[model samples]
Target: MPRKAPSITHKRSRASKPKVTTGCLTCKVRRIKCDESKPHCNRCLRTGRNCDGYAPPLPRPTAITTQPTSTIAHLPSLSAVLISLPGTPSERHSFHFFLSHTAPQLRGLFESPFWSQHVLQACLREEAIWHAAVALGAVHGRFYAEGGEGGERQMWEGEGFAIKQYVKAISCLTRRGGGERRIDVALMACVLFTCFESLRGHHAPALVHLDNGVNLLLELQSLEKPRNLITQTYPPTPYTPLSALQALLTRLDTQATQLLPSRHTRLHPVSTPPTHYETFISLEEAQRASDELWNYCLYTLQPSYPSPYLHPQPQPSHDDLAHRQASYATALTTYLTTKPPRTAREQQAGHMLRLHTLVATLSLSTTSLPASEDVWDTHTPSFAAIVDLARRIIDLDTDVDIYAPETGRVGLDTGVLGPLYLTALRCRDPMVRREAVELLKKERRREGLWDSTLLAIVAERAVGIEEGGCKSELDTGRISDVDVVFDPEGCRAGVRFLLEGGRGSVEGHRGLVLTTDLPRGQNTY
Candidate 1:
């Protein structure tokens, strides 16, 4: 009956079950089924809830693309650019390729308004436009040598171009700011001088550049004083930049005419004597210029990285060449002969003296000598001169000794003196040997000589003399029936006899004898 009723009723099919739905938190809060779409579901929008989309994690950035900010990155690249441009076209090409790629990055930095402004602000605050100028110079130099395939000639050209660009860029950077920086200009001038010096066949130009640079540096130096330039504001005043420009100009004026000797003077200085004076002046100026630059690098610029051009200078050794040897000898002789320098700077005079002594010893060892049985005959005068110098130095020590507490130790130790005496003994000349022996004995007497090694040498010489025996003193008195006495310890007996007996008479057995009847110890012969 129930089934017949349902069929007959034609009643609407049981209402379809409502679809089950779940919502995200945002949708649920609004009491709505969420499409659960990431970021913003419809339910979240209806409820006015914030629906943050699912954020996939961002991948880490790669390293190669990282940009450089300061001078550190530029220096190595600059050095690479310079060194690579010196050999072959291949090298030049490679360098060019590197520069071409890197230039864009540099250009990017240069074109950046933000970076430019920052640089300007930095230049104003620190007066360090030199850094910027140097960088610019490097860039320009690379750009200038734009052409060249890999070849040695190309490499040279590339290098030359780089140098030129460096000079020009520095010049530009340091130039008075028509909105430009001034310290950069001065630094550029200085760098130009340096470049000139480093380049072969460019000494004359280098001098010109140096003079210009010096003038600028001097002007800048004057401006560094607080009284000359005021700097107590937010963005520092423009005094430094202006001063730097002035400095560059001044150095340019001074260095241009003074770099090298003229061709005429190099061949015949007497004929063109004025050239000699000019050359000397030039050398002095160059030295002064170098010193000034070094000071600037140390004090003013205070570079974070060492200069690329600065290489470890190789020290000259004694055996470098014949010319070197002669030069060393001349220098030593000159220093030794000259009056001692007085200032704190010349405090190295003591060291110089030591060096001279070492040179003299080396000279003795190396100097050729003619064959001679006598050591003095070989090199008597030279040895005497050396000894004299040594004595003079020793005397200085003694002079210092009087004020020991104030002056500290005086003179070298006995260790040195002992060797000097041994050197004297090695002399072939008997007179020289005697003199050396006397000196050794004198040193022993003065220094309270206690070294065992020194004592052993003395002992050996004394033993040799005793074993060899010495000529006997001739006896003038006449005697009869002379009896000759010989003993193994005759040397000792002779010494004892000389000291004890005041008067004695004797005759040699082989020589003529005076015969007389006389008793032993009683008769007078």
Candidate 2:
């Protein structure tokens, strides 16, 4: 009022520049500045490229808007504080799930803190690795949400985020101009990608990633061993040996094949058993030697070296089976006596070696027996050994949280299911066979990429078919050929029981047709 004579009208000028706290993925990929417009960025639209939606908004800048004062001198920049904000809330949940649940299952036999310590450290430091870890966590979270309300919807959403993070991680690792050069991290990513594919039942792509990871692992191992460097990009950090990881990968590669005999041949050729198999210094060396012996048995028993049979075949000759069995026995005895099971992993390893030994013994015992009714009788001791070992495996792993078929704890490939399934299939004693089948059905946890449900069904069908074969053949002590066909791609399996040695006539019947689909309301991981 005092200055009413000269009232001044002040108009606020528009801000000189608009804020750009986030950019579109397209713009980020192209390494160009974005206008940060809603829905579509003008720069991407002008460049004739599809505008991928903008990344989630980042925190605002922290430049002082008020007068600088002595009391507010040492506050850190807002960028520094927000840099550690991982991602969206969903992303943070996935990472926490991975840290708490998924990491334990993936540890397998080795309790090394590699996944918990080293891999997590890398994830926090590297964006690409961080995305990959989040992707894997999202995948595992789908399983954790089993049987809950709105679980299917959550699973679907998790799948979407998992795929998005996977793509972003791949993009960051493979960007053309300048991308991540951390080979070790890349290898870890490949393994995570393999696990993702395996969860989705896409074994072919999983195998591709496994192969790539194996190659990268070899490269990294060479670098670490010869140069004493952690990786090409990290020289100052001492290289931690990946022996346990290598073993885990090896087991994963082996489990993908349908049959045990078929699994080992796809990889490297079986090495001859060394002379010092009996004098191993450590449990690891003993396990390696036992594996070589196991491989030898598998290679020797394969229907064909290069072309393995999809269905079961007659056992090999006595001489052939015996030679392999002898080597296996020596390795087994040496391992049991020399390499005491000091840890859970070594105990598991020793149990596995025993199972392998039993399998080889069973095969050798029933070799060329013509599949007569007396086949089971003749292999009584071997079957008993299998039953004993299978029981041991079940008893040893009481830590597993066994749930209903609807929601079971998925686990790493323990090398137990294969042996357990073998026991269920070959052991015809009704009590033993049913017990084995019950174990398989109860152990609903997945092992690595191996679906426990599928294996259990296949084994159940095999046992049922073998048991329900022509009663005439069973009564007359006639021979019959049992063929078990497993199609990993379709998750379909069938068993054919054909009686052959019954009065020189062939009687064939389709015993069981097993086709598996993903559980209802479950998303493809």
Which residue segments of model 2 deviate by more than 4 Å?
A: 1-87, 112-118, 125-128, 147-157, 173-187, 200-205, 211-246, 258-264, 269-272, 279-282, 296-353, 360-377, 399-409, 469-525
Q: Candidate 2 vs. truth: CA RMSD?
A: 19.7
Question: Residue 52 CA error for candidate 1 (Å)?
Answer: 78
Cα lDDT tens digits for candidate 1, 1-525: 001111112111222223223434333222235687754676555534454322222223222111213322222322232332332343243333323322222222112221223232232223223233333333333322222112312433334454454454455444546534444434443543343232222233444455455544443333335643423321143322433333333323322211111110010000110111111122223223222322222222111332222222233232333233344344444543463544221223333344344433443444334322232344566556545544554444322211111111111112224334444434444454455444443331111111212322332232223223223232322111212111221110001111112244332123332222111210000
Using alpha carbons, what is the TM-score of model 1?
Answer: 0.23
Query: How large is the C-alpha RMSD of every model relative to the true structure?
Result: 38.3, 19.7
| Candidate 1 wrong stretches, greater than 4 Å | 1-322, 335-376, 401-419, 444-525
For model 2, where is the 10-residue window of minimal lDDT?
1-10
Candidates in order, TM-scores: namely 0.23, 0.59
Q: What lDDT does model 2 reach?
A: 0.54
**How far does residue 367 in candidate 2 sit from its true spot (Å)?**
6.5
lDDT tens digits by residue: candidate 2, 1-525: 010011121222322233233586555433346888977888766645556564333443232121112211232322232334466766765665565456655765444445645556556555666788788888776765542335333543546788898888888678623332545556667767887766654555666788787665545544225454534443234222344456556566655543423243444322355433335465555556555555555545544543231232344455755765576577667757865765444665577667766675666666556745567665655666676776676565532322112334455544566666666666657777777666666554566756545556555555554566434334323223434444345333344434434333422332222223333223222
